[model samples]
Each structure stands twice: as C-alpha cells, then as structure tokens.
Target chain A: MSEKIDRRMLLKATAAVLGAMPLAGCDLASQDPTVRGILDSAEELTEAAQRTLLSRQSLAREFPETAISKHFRANGSDNPDDGDYQRLARSGFADWRLDVGGLVDHPLRLSLTDLRAMPSRTQITRHDCVEGWSCIGKWTGVPLGGVLQQAGLKANARYIVFYCADTFGDSLDLPNKYYESIDLVDAFHPQTILAYDMNGKPLEVPYGAPLRVRVERQLGYKMAKYVMRIEAVESFGHIGGGRGSFWADRGYEWYAGI
Target chain B: MVRATHWIGVVCVTILLLSGLQIFNAHPALYLGMDSDFAHPAASIGVAQRGERKIGVTTVFGRSFDTTGLLGVSGRNDAAERAFPAWATLPGYQDLATGRRWHFFFAWLLVLDGLAYLVFSLASGHVWRDLIPPARQLRRIGASVLDHLRLRFPRGEEARSYNVLQRLSYLAVIFVIAPLLVLTGLTMSPALDAVFPFVAPLLGGRQTARTIHFICAFLLLGFALVHVAMVLLSGVWNNMRSMITGWYRIKPEGSLHVGEN
Candidate 1:
C-alpha cells in the first residue's frame, strides 16, 4: 500500500510538472474564450467521473451505536419561529400534513401517523456539512422512493423539489421559504428517506422535526430540513431564482455531491 | 514548460487559498475528535463587534487572541463582520456556492497540469537529473541550508542547477502536499465516502482530513511566498525569462552575485 501511494505521488508530481509544458507554447488555449469554455464544461466531466465511480445505489457509511455524536450542532435555520410551524410543534405535529403535489398522478397529503405506518427504514449515517463538520445519528422514516411510487410521478417529472416550513433572512415570503431539489436518480435511491425520528426518538426542532428529506449521498444542505411538501416537477425553471435550491439560488452548486 | 506550469500553479493556488478561507469562515471552527460541540472546539476563529469596533478573534484550545482588522472585520464602514474580506474570496462575496465552484474548477486544472508535468519530466529525465539533487550535493546539503539562511545564493554554473533546499522543497510540494490535499478533499465528500470508506479511518476521520487540508494549504502558501522572495532576490529578470522563454542568462564565473541572508 505504501509503495502504491509513493508511485501515485510520483506520477502526480510528474504530471503537474508536465502539465506546465503546454502553457509555454499554447497561446490559443490560454485565450479567455477557450478557458471559459473548458471551465463551463468541466462540471459535467467531474459529475460523470463521480457517478461512474460509485453506483447510484451505493450506500453511505453507517456507524456503530457508540459513534453517534453527543451534540449535533444545529445549522442554518434551527427553528422556523413562524406561527404555523410553532402551532404544529405545540400540538405534537398532529395538524401537520405533507402535501405531495405537482407532476404526479396522485397528489397525496400524508399525516405523521400515515407516514409512520408506511414501510420504513432506519440507518445510522453521518451528516457531512459543507461548512466542514460531521455528525452521526440513526434516522427512521419511510423511503422517499416508496412515497413517490405511491404518489405516482408523472412521466415528464425530472426533479423532486422539497418545500420546507423554515424561512430565512427575517422573511416569511415565498422566496425565503427554504426549498431544495433532487433528480429522480437520487430520489429513488434506497437510502433516501423522509425521516421523522433521530437517534431512537422524535427529531428535535433544531434537527428538522416532524419530517425532513435525507439525501444521504449529498451534503447536509441537500437533506432539506423541516419539510412540509414534496413536489415532482419537470424542471426547476420557475423556482426561486431559477436555481434548484435556496442555497443554489444564492451561490452554492446545485449538485453538491461533494 | 516549467515556467508555464509554475505560473498556472500560482494563479490556481491563489484562487484556492482565498476561496478556501471563505469556506472556512462559514463554520469558523475545527475539531480533532470524532465528534464536536458548540460549547467547546479544539480551535475556533470568528468575528464579533464591541462598541463600534469589529474584532476578529481566534480561539485555540480555550485560549483566545484578538485577530481583529485582518480577519473577522470587513474594511467597509458598515462594520458588518465576516471572517475573511470580500476581496480575498473568489466571487468577492460570502457565497459558498460560487467559492466552491471556483475552487473545484481550478483544482481540476491544477491536478491535470500536475499530471502532464509528471509525465513530461519523467520522459525528459528532468526529475532525476534536475529536480533530485546530485549525490555530491547531498554531502553539502547542510551548507546549502546555511547559505540560504545567510541570504547567499549560487551564481554562474551553480545558479543554473537547483540547490539542495530548492530540490527538497519542490519535491515535497509536488509529491506530498498536493496529493494529500486532493485525497483529504475527496475524504470529505459523502459520495466518495461510499466509494472509499477506508479513507475516513485512514486519515483519522473527515474532520481530521479537513484540518489537514487547511494545514497543507497554508504550507503551500508559505512555500509560494518563499519561492517568490527567492526569485526576486536571485534575479527576477533572469528567473522570469527562464520560466517564460526557457532561456536563462547564466551569470559568468566571478560576477560577484549579491547575497541577502
């Protein structure tokens, strides 16, 4: 293993030194138009490489019981602080309903009991935040694929957009309401779930109570918290800022597999 | 070829550093353990305001230091606190998404460029002949370090060949730091975690990998600074020309090169 690592390092160093060779002679490649074009297309190239390495169904690592962190620090909007969310939380989320609408054959509204009664899965997985932190917890909820199957996604549907109750930047406006989206490839992944339980108990408000979508393969931000609805859409063109998610709309990469 | 690669490295590394700092500011804390808490961090750096003044604070293992103006406090009159100023970051704003895009895009270029450099250097025997110090230089490596410290540099034929310190530093950056940075970076991704599960434990966990990544980046930066200083002191025109046109005007013997220790 050590020898292999050494060989790899040698190759990389050699390549980096060799990589510089073209710059001395190729003025055309250095041109702004050509460089911009390469940068634009590089995203797809990287995405393809990652997907090719791991199958879509590949499972994220699951930790042992003892590995769970004592304190999984709350990030972004820990609490909605809105009247509707507060009311639902006070009433044990009995009145809360998950509106599954948009480009689906059957638009269903599911209560927490209905979701719990459905076939479920529980797995201990790590939540990797883009901000460079991680936490492990056991999540229990129904698979998002199962729910989507029940709702019967329309043939044209290209994305699964999760609408959440949490609002950002001191506004309850539509644009501020936190929303995230995932394509069908991720939507149907076996590990993807709408979790209601955390670490053998009900999820606390700070950790997205009632329910949240867990796209385990992506970063924590992709796991839309405080989810109130799931919408199957052909495209996210009309979504806030025409970007797939709230953070994506701001400046984050919509495909945050890293 | 060498000059082109060196300059590309310069631009990419600059983008990586500024954008990376911005990304670090988002959380502004690092931990060594398997798990972490807000109440205590192994190390934390952030900004706060006190009575019309903004302060950048860095706390390491419970000890705090005031970083202030340089970090945590923006130069703008509004006094809004940000960990790193906008100018240093890629988009010149507190946008992680854009910062990441810039970081990743340039990261690929750097790696690809590295690969090309490696293949070419090996084929040309540049690695063994030029980069690796000759066996005789090994015995006199101590003198090389002392000379560097004393601000003395080689001239004439000696100047054309890299000294022991130059060879070692360049080799370390190429063979150690760059690869480690890429591997540690991959370790942080959940998708890659699925593919290479052993990386986490091997590197002591994702957080540890992140800390190491930061450390490696700073080391690279330090190398760059020293490299530029060496270039300027040695002979900026000659050095720049050597990299650009691949023609170095070697000083004649007994030219009396100035030494700055």
Candidate 2:
C-alpha cells in the first residue's frame, strides 16, 4: 500500500508537469501571427458554412405581444452625447432627416414624416445581444426594402451601410460613429425594418429615436441605432475600417448571426 | 483512429476552453430567465471598483463572493481587467471577433471529431465492450470505488478490461456532456433559432442556453482533468500505448513485463 501511494504521487507529479506544459504556451499562442491567420481563415470558414445553412429569406422568430419584455434594454450608444444630436432631440427630432444616397439612381433625404407615411411593418422579435443578454420588443417601422426600392438601388450595390448620429470617442478615437451594414439579401428581407417606434409608442431617445435598423435574424449589435444616413455601396472598402460596422471596427464580427 | 481523434479532440477542446472563456468575459454574467436585467445580473463573474482598489466579485443566486486574485479582478493594480485574464483566452486582447473565429473553428472540429468517435465506437461495439460496465462489473462497483480510493488497481487480465468506475466516467462524458454542449451551443445561434423555432424555447431561452453552455464547458473541463489524472495513475506508458498503438503490454500481478505471466 505504501509502495502504491508512492507510485500514485509519482504519477500525480508527472501529470502536473505535463498539464503545465501547454499552459506555458498561452502567451506564445496569442503572439503567434500564424495562429492569428488561421483564426481569421476559421472565421471566414464559419461565415461561409453558416451562410450555406441559412436561407436568404428565412425570418427570425417573432413572439406574441405578451412575450415582449417590460423594458427592451437599449444597446450600444443609448444616448448620443453629441451637440447636434442633443439639438435635434430638444425639438423632438422634427428636423431629423434620413439621408439615403450612394450607388442609387435617386438619392433620398426623407424626413421622419415621410418614413411614417411609407409602407411599414410592426414586428415583436427578440433581440439577442453579443454580450449574451436578450430582450423582446415590438418594433413599428417602414420596411427597409420598400425604402431602398424607392431609392432605386444601383446594379453595382452589394452592401447597405447604415450610419448613425451617435458617435464614440473623438478625433483621437478614429471615426467610430456607430455604423452597421448588411448584405443585399438581409437588406431585402421583409422583416428588415428601420424602426421608428417601439412598444406602441414613439421610440425613446435611449432606444435610438428617429430610427434604428432592426435586422432581427442577427445579433443586437448589427442593429445600428440613431438614424442619420443610409448609404448603399458596392463594398465597405472606404468605410470605417472596411469591416462593415463600428463594432466590427472595434474587433467584433461583422456578421453576428450567432 | 481513437488516438488521432483523441489528439484532435485535445487541441480543439483547448482552443474552445480559452476562446469560450474570453467570450464569456465579453458578458461576464449569465441568467436563467429569458429576458435579463441589463443593469443588474442574477449571476456575474467580473470586477467591481471598491474604493481605491478594483476587487473581483463573483455573484451567484444573488450572493456575492470575492474572487479577487483570479476572477472579477486580475492583473496588477491599475492595469487590472475583468473576469478571465488575457492569457486564458484566445485573442489575448479583448477582440471578440478573433476569439469567436478561434472558437467556431475549433468547435466544428470538436463536433466532427466527437461524431466520428461516437459512430466508430457504436459500430465497433467499443461503447458496449469497453466503455459500458457489464452486469458483473456493475455488481462490484462498490469494491471498485473502495479499491480506487485505496489506490489499488486490477492486475493482469482484469487490467485489460476497464473497471466499473472507468466505464461510467467514459460513458457519461461521451454520451451526456458532449451532446449537451453541442445542443446548447446550437440553441444560442439566432439563425439556428430561426430554422428550429423550438430550440430556444425548449431550452428555456437563448440566455439560458448560454448559461448551460458555460456550465457544460466547466463540466467538460472537470472531466478532462480527472481523465488525465486517471491516465497517469493507471500507468502512463501502458495506457498511452493502448491509445497511441493498438497493443498495450500489460504486466502480470507481481511482474514488470507481460511475458512473466
């Protein structure tokens, strides 16, 4: 029994040493550019694999009105601290205009009233955040597809980028004024709306007043808040970091379906 | 085939652990309810400012515990960050994009490897013959436990077949924990949620699935630790040879070599 105990201790020591070996490589693994390249390739592979499995027209789950949360928690940039945004908010956004231009037959600068008057959709869908929280809210807005149709998208347009009023950081922080983009497929989806109202009331400032994109099938960060402009583009090459969204610029996945 | 799959499993699982921890740190809190209170969390593992110092706090079921050094608070003084340390995660920096890239890449490998192993084991009757305890072994489980606690192992012919404890642990990990991890992982994806409307609801909610995923990962980690320990204690060379090669030179009861039998 004593000899058995000795063997057990010896084995334990050996195992401990072996276990620590890989852990020692943690820093090395992170620093290795080769690993980073592999990871990037992996992300592309994942995106391709998921896209293959996902139908372009499949709608995200819509819940009953009763299931809507009491408070649909506001995500990133809940309130725009910018002076211009504050000035517009002071007048209840009466002067707010949503600019739709770039790669379009006709550029549109539509006011809040024009958007309200257009063909709209109301959907109660769950918002899944990248930070792992979820909330349900009833969004009433004009279908983005109809709005884009009015603008007459150019044949070269491949991505629709939504620029927002809310800005993060300053000149020192680079051009990180919250922006998100979706492929033409998601943009043309029936459920993709530019929400102007929530829970039977006009959108609160914290909830991105004036307008917010509701790409329900994706995670919450893809839903860029605070309406400013919508630019249809052939590619996001010239956009902020050319990765599609502000969060993407800050190292979050451009495609946040998961 | 088992050796190849096992090594791949090791690499993938390691990446998954580091990346998964990083992803968890992005939120640092989990909830059982469908809709979480963004302001406050029911359970959280992150740092909080306590006067001049940043103290780590881990809260569960509304109770808070100071896990300052390891969790909640990490790094030196002012440089301290929240939840998991950088070394323990994939990207090292707080890049969710890169972390996720590593996670999904390894996650697919893990799933494929597990599936292959499962199919192979089932078809070859390895699950029944090796991983599952026979009725006779089941009856001696109490003795097996006693022997294990006393550091006594089977010898000669008995060593060739797994004891009841080994069978059960292998069975539990291969069947229960692995599938749960995969299913719960799928439950969190919005696209998958769209395809299978029942997934999120059936699992309670997406947040709930995330919580379960976290829990399942820890369970897998625990299983891995114990599994490694077992491999060491059971005779590293012999066990490793059995896995790496098809043959294991099992020593007889009182001898160092198999031929002595």
- lDDT against the true structure, each candidate: 0.82, 0.83
Using Cα atoms, each model's DockQ against the true complex is 0.33, 0.41
In DockQ, how does model 2 score against the reference complex?
Answer: 0.41
Q: Write the per-residue lDDT of candidate 2 for residues B1-261, one digit (tens) a residue.
A: 666677778878888999898788888988876667666676898778889888888999889998887887776663667688766776566766667777887888899999888888889888878888889999999999999888777877888888899889878888888888898898787777877777878888877888888898999899899888888997888888686555778664555544444
Report the lDDT tens digits of candidate 1 across residue range B1-261: 665677677767876787688788777787775555657877887776678776788888899888776666766663657776665655565666555766788888888888888888888898999889888998998898899988888877888888889999999998999999999888888889888888888898888888888889999989999999998988899997686556789755555534321
lDDT of 2 by residue, A1-258 (tens): 997787568557756745754644654655567866666565576667678877888788898988898767776777899899999999999999999999999999999999999988999998888877788899999999999999999999999999889987554555868888999989999899999999999999988998999998788989888979999999997898778888777656787777
Model 1, residue A91: C-alpha shift (Å): 1.8
Tens digits of per-residue lDDT for model 1, A1-258: 997787568557756765753422222332345654555455676678788998888888888999888888778889898889999999999999999999999999999999999999999988988887888889999999999999999899999999999887654444888899999989999999999999999989999998988888888999988999999999998997688998877656677778
Error of 1 at B186 (Å): 1.6
What does chain B score (TM) in every candidate? 0.92, 0.92
Residue range with the least summed lDDT across 10 consecutive positions in model 2 chain B: B252-261
The candidate that achieves the highest TM-score relative to the unseen native structure: 2
